[model samples]
Target: MTELALLVQGLLDGSIYALIAVGLTLVYGLLRILHVAHAALFTLGGYVGVVVTNETGSFILALVAAMIVAGIAGMIIYRLVYQPILHLPPYVALIASIGLFIAMQEGFRFYDEQGVSYVNPPVQGTLELAGQTLQLAKIVTFFVAIILIGGLGLLAAKTRTGVAWRATVTMPAMAESFGINIIQVRYINFFIGSALAAVAGVMVSLTTNLVEPTSGDVWSYKALAIIVLGGLGSMRGTLIACFALGVLEAFATTTCVPLGNIQICLGEIMNRDAIAFAFLVIVLMIRPQGLFVRA
Candidate 1:
């Protein structure tokens, strides 16, 4: 049962991180923004979604409205800030995104320290699976993350914007020459990627039963690690990295170490992500392009 519990918890946490990674990678691939604002946007999603859900008493509607609002926020950022940076050095855009991230964090800090409050779990029941009992909310979070990934996969494969987005990612000038309306496609990527970030925020709030402004900052790095370890712009590789990180996190926690010689407090940094970063460092040192690179 302990082993199974570790498995379930690991997957749930990893799936949540992967969702954030997809949104992060999408924006990075399309706009080359290196979005520092993603953490802010993710936290905003949680806060706003919580407010809407508490007010309207409708789970589904809260998600829809929150994502739409967040997408608008993304559009504004793109039009006002990022679009102008096209002619500038890449580092300029990077700096702007980081500034945006800090601004969002401070903005949220001004609003609430208790932060965007969350609702109690709607489905409080537990299900026994694989010889372990788990909360329905956790299970839902796992599946919902997968569904979002699946939906995005379909969009990438089937939609006109997806094709244009891909072309823009690979060769923006060439895509422009082909009449792809690169600007419009950039906006589309911005909106869709932002919406996915919001979805991740909502999933996290649901899973943890709390929302805070600082939450997004912690999550953004994990998503970045996923991108680094998964091979840049490889969606499939990113998802695989997510699960592998999740599993590694779970096993590490469960595998006990002799604390007598350990200098640091294990409890302070016991979660899967810390270990995942160490693994990432090791892997990158070894392979560099991640585990799933092509010839």
Candidate 2:
């Protein structure tokens, strides 16, 4: 791929990461929990999308259903699992989240050990742009992510709900005293976050045409690295980190380096995940508080 093509591909990849990481950042910012079960929710969305699309042959309907179901599940998790344990140490909630993730994965495996795939994907074929061929599903995924992320930005910046969310994050006691419903804000946070994850999951399934029981495993780790690298709980930082990682990974995997007389691609040397985490480690060594966190 040409330089411009690689750049575009990286940005497109970043859009997906942004969708996944944004949810983690939001939940962490508000509740100070890692929410590892989010990955399971993502996988759940993919399975739901696959089933709905196969049954109804409507991709739009699948997306909507996945978002609604995942959003509701998120709210329930918050109310039932996290609420009672909020006063405990943060690690306690994190452990519970990990357990929930494992249990959900097992449940999915029990449901379909072989995983699932979309029988009638809504988008097909590819588009050539800037000397690169891009999948139509990926293009759709990019646009959907942009719309959702942009809408999230608008919600955070322009609405009364945004004000309440910010207040709750900064000063929950004061927010409640001032008539803001902290519980509602928390619920909204999880709903929006989980919904975004579901959309991402559906998009991934569409792009790949497959949804495995463990589809979200790799993403869960990458999302954790992204939120932490971006500065835990910092949405803007998370967005920046997502794109940065994407572009870096793109170049790392595709660009060839001259070693002696032979051209060696980094992809041949280290996989994309290793490249991402190596970058994270390098960045953290320099900026221990994270790329965007204030000292």
- Strongest candidate by lDDT: 2
Residue 243, model 1, lDDT: 85
> Given candidate 2, what's the lDDT at residue 129?
93
Regions more than 4 Å wrong, model 2: 259-264
Question: Candidate 1 vs. truth: CA RMSD?
Answer: 2.9
Clashing residue pairs in candidate 1 are: none
lDDT tens per residue, model 1, 1-295: 5777787778987888887888777777776667878778888888888888888888788888768988889889999988888789999998998898888888988888777665554445788887777778777878888887888888877998778878888899999999999888877777877887888888778767678878887788878888778886677788888888877777775676566787554335656566777888999999998876522
For model 2, residues 157-188, the per-residue Cα lDDT tens digits are 89999989998888899999999989999999
Off by over 4 Å in 1: 257-271
C-alpha lDDT (0 to 100) for residue 254 of candidate 1: 60
Q: After superposition, how far is residue 96 of candidate 2 from its true place, in Å?
A: 1.4
> What lDDT does model 2 reach?
0.91
